[model samples]
Target: MTYCVGMMLDAGLVFMSDTRTNAGLDNISTFKKMTSWETPGERAITLLSSGNLATTQAVVSLLEERPHAHGERDPSILGVPSMFQAARLVADTLREVIAQHDAAGQQADSAFGATLILGGQIKGGPPRLFMIYPEGNFIEASSDTPFFQIGETKYGRPILVRAYDPKMSFEAAIKLLLVSFDSTVKANLSVGAPFDFHFYRKDSLQLDTTGRIDADNPYLQLISQGWGDALKNALESLPDFALE
Candidate 1:
């Protein structure tokens, strides 16, 4: 299990993903859940994944191989003309990978299923975000739905609904996502830390910033403690209910 989020903002796009994957109480490991492709000035694409690790890894490997597959180099993601086409290519690739592994019997359905969040910019189009399902179909984020969260989502969705702002600075957006990820991590053991994050300013056609945030990172620790204190204070400040 993991917690990954991608936000579509007026300033640009932001993404974050936790690195934990658990098979049982004693069987747990950390693996990167984010992958990205960039072409300097032409385009920048990112993928945040959840669900079966094997399936997700296979999908990413396929996409990455496109640029070097065989003796011929295909158009690949770097050559896609628009964000919309990029999303379609990703969906098609995901679907094909699943179909290839789905024949492994009943276990395949559960073990080979995966979900992804795709976002970025293609030179000619605006930045875009999409939540792609295990079935390969996806929905784009819009004004009404400006962000997408996958895996262990229920725990952190409320804050996003109440606090998201289209015009907030890139710093504020990262802070908000950290709070959300912290909430999910506390509620679910399947999700842990050493999160990976990235930001892309619209039309920049390059990744603006990217880094790994570990559990001991001071800023992350502050956000966790601060959010808890703020919640308790809010609860205590609310008007008391009186029974008539």
Candidate 2:
């Protein structure tokens, strides 16, 4: 299991994903679930993946390999003319990979299934974000749905719902995502982090910032402890229920 989020903001886009994958209690490992491609002054693209690791990796590999493969007719994510076309290329690659692994082919419930969050900007269009499913279908972020989450999403969604502001600064957006991730890591054993994050400023056509947040990071520690204390204080301040 993993947790990945991509948010569309007026300022730009913010993405984060955890690095944990586990087969069982004794067989847990860390693998980065985030990948990005950048052609400065042209485009900047990032993908966050969840579900079958093999399927996700293969999808990414194929996308990366297409441009270099001899006689490759398909447009690479980097060469796509618009963010929408880039998303289509990713969705198609995801379905192609899943079909290769599963005889059933592109079934959402198939063992080979994976889901992806694709977000970034191409030279001629505004920054865009998409959630692509195993079945080669996707939905873009809109004013009505300003974010996308894939994998272990339940534990962290409330924070995003209550607190997200489209107008917020990029700094505030990152802090919000970290708190959401902290909540998820605490609730799910399969979702431990050393999270990876990317921040893209709209029209920059280049990745503005990217980094990893480890389990022992001081700011993570502060947010985790501070949020807990604040939540407890809020609960305690509420009127107590009395059984009649």
Candidate 3:
């Protein structure tokens, strides 16, 4: 299992994914779920994937190979024209990969299947974000809903609901995401460490920063601890549960 999210903000985009792929007890391993493609000052795109490992990997590998005129050989995200076009290509690629895999005798149902969060910008357009479905369709983030998450999102959604604001500055959004990730890491064992974060400022067409956050990282620890205590304090102060 995995957890990956892409947040669209007035400031730019925030993408994050946990590297842990928890198959079962004794089967855990780290596999980066974030993929990036860029043309430096021209375009920057990032994808966060969740679901079947084989299916997702095959989809991405084929996407990188999409440049044979039919967009079947480009291979990576770096060459797509616009963020919207890029997403369409990603969705189409995912469908093909799933069909090809299962057509040869593998289970590839759309439910409990792979999904992706795609985000970034082209030099001429504002940064945008989307959540791509297995069916080769997607929905973009809007001013009313400036972020999207795939996989185990329930654990972290409350923080996003409480803190996300379309008007927040870049730094503020990062802080919000950190808290959200911190909450997720604690409540779910299926999602684990070595988190990947990509921060882009709108129009930069270049990633401002990308880094791996592992366990024992000081700032993440602080955020986690603070959020835990805050939740406890809030619960303690709430009116007691009423008897039936």
Candidate 4:
């Protein structure tokens, strides 16, 4: 399990993902969950994934192969004309990859199932975000909902709902995501560190930041410690329930 979010903001796009994959109590590992493809000026596309690691990785590999498969050196996300088409291409390719794997009798539906949060911008457009399902269909994020999150979601969604604002600074947006990730990490062991995060400013057409955040990241430590202590202090200061 993991937690990955892609926020579509007026300023740009913010993406964050955890690198944990757990099979059992003793079987756990870390692998990157964020992938990006860009043409420097033409367009940029990012994929943040959660769920069956193999299936997600296979799908991503297939996406990267479009150009080669098409007998061209340049058919790719960066070549796609719009964020919409790029997402469709990802969904279609995911469906094909998963279906083929299932047909080979080498995997289970649940084991090959995965989900993605896709986001970025094309030359003439605003940033956009989409949630691609295991079935390879998806929906776009709108201003009414400026962000999309996947995996271990129920635990972390509330913070995003509360803190996400289109006008908020990019730094604030990431802080909000960290708070959200922290809450989920405390409640679920399947999602662990190190985390993958990337920031893409609108029209920049380059990765602003692509890095790993480990269990001991300073900001994360502060939130996990300071916030928990603050909550405890707040609860202790409140009147206790009367024994009625």
What are the per-residue Cα lDDT tens digits for candidate 2 across 1-244? 9999999999999999999998887899999999999999999999999999998989888888977787778798878899999999999989988887886554555888899999999887999999999899999999999999999999999999999999999889989999999999998999987999999999999988999999999999999989999889989999999999
Candidate 3 or 2, higher lDDT: 2
Please state every model's RMSD to the true fold in angstroms. 1.5, 2.1, 3.0, 2.6
Put the candidates in TM-score order, highest first.
Answer: 1, 2, 4, 3
Tens digits of per-residue lDDT, candidate 3, 8-76, equal: 777788888998886776799899999887778998888899998887888777766554346445434
The true-versus-predicted C-alpha distance at residue 71 of model 4, in Å, is 2.3
Better of 1 and 3 by TM-score: 1
Please give, for residues 1-244, the per-residue lDDT of candidate 1 as tens digits: 8899999989999999999999986899999999999999989999999998888998888888887766655557766798888888888888887777776565524567788999999887889999998888999999999999999999999999999999988899999999999999999999999999999999999888999999999999999999989999989999889999
Q: Say which candidate scores most in lDDT.
A: 2
TM-score of model 3 (CA atoms): 0.88
Best of the two (3, 4) by lDDT: 4
Worst 10 residues of 4 by lDDT: 67-76
Candidate 4's residue-wise lDDT over 165-188, tens digit each? 888887888778888888999999
Candidate 3 global lDDT: 0.82
Q: Backbone clashes in each candidate structure, one number apiece?
A: 0, 0, 12, 0
Mark the regions of model 1 whose C-alpha exceeds 4 Å error after superposition.
70-74, 107-109
TM-score of each: 0.95, 0.94, 0.88, 0.90
